[model samples]
Target: MQAMQQQRQSAAPGALAAFARFVLCGGGVGVASSFAVAGLSSWMPWALANALITVVSTLLATELHARFTFGAGGRATWRQHGQSAGSAAAAYGVTCVAMFALQRFVEAPGAVVEQVVYLSASALAGVARFAVLRLVVFARNRSEGAATARPVCVPEGHVLTPAGAAGFCRAA
Candidate 1:
């Protein structure tokens, strides 16, 4: 094992497990938001009701993802929170697009059917969210006493100096 070779966590959970946990957390949030929207719609403006629900769900989802999905706790920075919030907004946009397509192109028979379609769309968004969270927002060395991922120099054109190493790794 050369110093330039990267060392990654051998015990890190597989992608499937992380995705499963993500789905579990997202499903709970989605179910609660759906009910909240329905309950609020009777008294509030439809747009406002939906918006509030989205905001609350996004907040809850971010914490849930940080703790359960990526296993990072007590170290979330403002930048990380911002990215998580942005990912939530992006996922909501995906759901909205799916809903629009369903309503405009396909004739759904009833509200229940529409809800099912929406849930399916949310699942796709969940997958996207999991990938983004794993790759960007909550990515860190959370493994207790385990090896964490490190940067490695590429095989060819490997440089020894710090300045040259940075350039070489990026260029490779």
Candidate 2:
């Protein structure tokens, strides 16, 4: 059916937009967190500083993805916060395991190599984070009652139809 095809087609653009936002926002968080960690490391153990920066940045990144990337309400509810926490925990576990494997087997002999390995692990974990955020954490539940409708954000100049979403330009 044409309607079914259109419906299927409509979601991809929004998903792509969300993915773009996720990558940009996540990269920004990573860069800022790294700088914070670098500064903090001079005053404390590297591990301690890294953990401190990561924790804050992870929470902020979750909120950004939920609000800006997925157009979920900017206000984070308890449920949303919990979901973000869960996603971050899962992502952290994956990242740690990947980094451990790389360190155990690879010839990462210098600071640069170690940083590259870390970044690669983080990037891989980020893919998982995006999946969880889209499918579970910030998903739009269509079955909710009218009274439970979420305050979705629609940027100016984008069209949101029943079959489509908040961050796309409609073709004339």
Candidate 3:
């Protein structure tokens, strides 16, 4: 019983770290998508540009989230990707419609109204995506323990082990 508690305590830090990494990766993708849509809006309709950017950016973000955040890699078959993509598409469509409606109803300056609507809708959409990803897309399997025990390299050669490198692996 004590060992289980200790294990859970130790796992808390790793879970928090993973969540931070996921947020950073997702934020990068969001920023890129926003910029892409904003820039392309000059030539195309904002909705169309936003949809294009969301599809491309979400695909990239999903790979990062699956491998780093969830510690699940071999699970990302084509079918899984398709399912995730469909989920994201549905979320994006709803977000777009909500933002559009807000823009139309909120009688404020154009820029202010646009920003407010997009920010609120994006936040809601992000939470929805996270819930779906956790519950459905990257749902943990029985092999999760084995997978989480291994080390993962973030960038370059900087590696992070499940229980800190020194605890999990040591020089012999």
TM-score for all predictions? 0.67, 0.65, 0.66
Better of 2 and 3 by lDDT: 2
Collision pairs in model 3: none
Write model 2 residue lDDT over 1-172, tens digit each, in one string. Answer: 5854644443322788889999999978876765676578689976667667767987788778756777664555678778777877766666567556766888655556656766776788788888887888766531232345446666777677856662343343
* Stretches > 4 Å off in candidate 1: 1-12, 105-109, 141-172
Give each prediction's root-mean-square deviation over alpha carbons.
Answer: 9.3, 10.4, 10.6
> Which consecutive 10 residues in model 1 have the weakest lDDT in total?
3-12
Clashes of 1: 0
**How many backbone clashes does every candidate have?**
0, 0, 0
lDDT of each: 0.70, 0.69, 0.68
Candidate number with the higher lDDT (1 or 3):
1
lDDT of 3 by residue, 51-146 (tens): 888888877888877766665643355655776787778768876897678767776546555665666676677777776776677765324555
Worst 10 residues of 2 by lDDT: 141-150
Which of candidates 1 and 2 is the stronger one according to TM-score?
1
